[model samples]
Target: MLKHSDIWRAIDRLAHRHGLSASGLAKRGGLDPTTFNKSKRMTPDGKLRWPSTESIAKVLEATGSSFTDFVAMTGEEGDGTGGGAGMSAAAMRRVPVIGYAQAGNDGYFDDAGYPAGNGWDELEFPHVADDHAYALEVSGDSMEPVYRDGDIIIVSPAASVRRGDRVVVRTRDGEVMAKQLARQTANRLELVSLNRSHPDRSLPMADVAWIARIMWASQ
Candidate 1:
């Protein structure tokens, strides 16, 4: 039988595995920063406060984790690889990785934004269910604080992007940049840089070749 503590321990382990504190994990999951705080884990009267299923689901989605991974972290009978044991094999996919500098090069990607020929490296990660999923390696300090040098970001062309979503935008001029979507109109787009030192950018939508939403990052 699994105890409540076992579940809590699994959550803590999951957070640590992602190099995040409880509050950091909560924020990444789109929850209130205090959602996983120690105070929230117990009532003032000392009664245990269980995590909500919705919150767990959100965290799993944010972390690209399957139910099997969660169970493995619970010290279950299976190997603790967090490999999504109970999930389908298709859940694991090889994504092409490219440096930020190469991303702006022409002929590297097809018209649909899929990687084309050679000169590409690959990484295996949990599939985000997008065939156009790819990875971009951060190379400079332009996107620091949010994304450091050497961090790999997973981008999904098929993923729906909205205001506030981090996105990789390629322009017709061969400029590729990662920025937060500040505003989007049918004719124009406004982007906010991650680094405070950089100024916001605005571009005509017609100047963009493609824009993909960033799903996750391997910090």
Candidate 2:
């Protein structure tokens, strides 16, 4: 059976493969731009809203994908969670997400900064090779101007961090902050705050618990 979420995930994967948003895919298919949007995937009363066959046909034509191709993407198995359902090799990924404040707490992450316990809400996003990639939902305006409150920022612990790149850094004192790397050395790290209203941070490397590069953020 094709689960509703699986079909939507397939549509999202299809759009991603073609470098388009779901709305962009719909517009290319001659449908309303919001046809495949996440909001349209469910009704206001929280009812499932499956995509119409005609819309699927139009999208297939727009992207030059066969019905078989679409079905393959759908996986026809389950939600892309357990048993690797709705998988297209690595086109769909489910990552853990928790609030920024919660992430600062212990037990959520291991010493290496990888997701540790099951205290996260899973969210499906575009293909990401890093299995340790997770997202932190911003809680306050401290990271404003660049990442506002409620923004979900994708962080990759496996991704390399460099100077001038935005990163999520945790301190030995259990403080979590998102800032740009001004400098990093064997003994110290210099960070520039995203919001100029906040002061820049310079910390000894020993005081740094772990740091992961911010890969993407929901706008």
Q: Which candidate number has the best lDDT? A: 2
Candidate 2, after superposition: displacement of residue 125 in Å? 1.3
Query: Candidate 2, residues 1-219: lDDT per residue as tens digits?
Result: 888977887887676555455655676687986687667889999999999999999999987988877777776564333445545646768777667877889888899989888835456676788999987777678988887654567899999998889999999888999999999999999999999999999999999999999998865
Worst 10 residues of 2 by lDDT: 78-87
Deviating ranges (above 4 Å) for candidate 1: 1-88
Q: Which 10 successive residues of model 1 have the least lDDT summed?
A: 77-86
Would you list the C-alpha lDDT of every candidate in the order shown? 0.78, 0.80
lDDT of 2 at 203: 99
In candidate 1, residue 197 scores what lDDT? Answer: 93
| Count of clashing pairs, candidate 2 | 0
* RMSD of each predicted structure: 13.5, 8.6
Tens digits of per-residue lDDT for model 1, 174-203: 899899999999999999998989888999
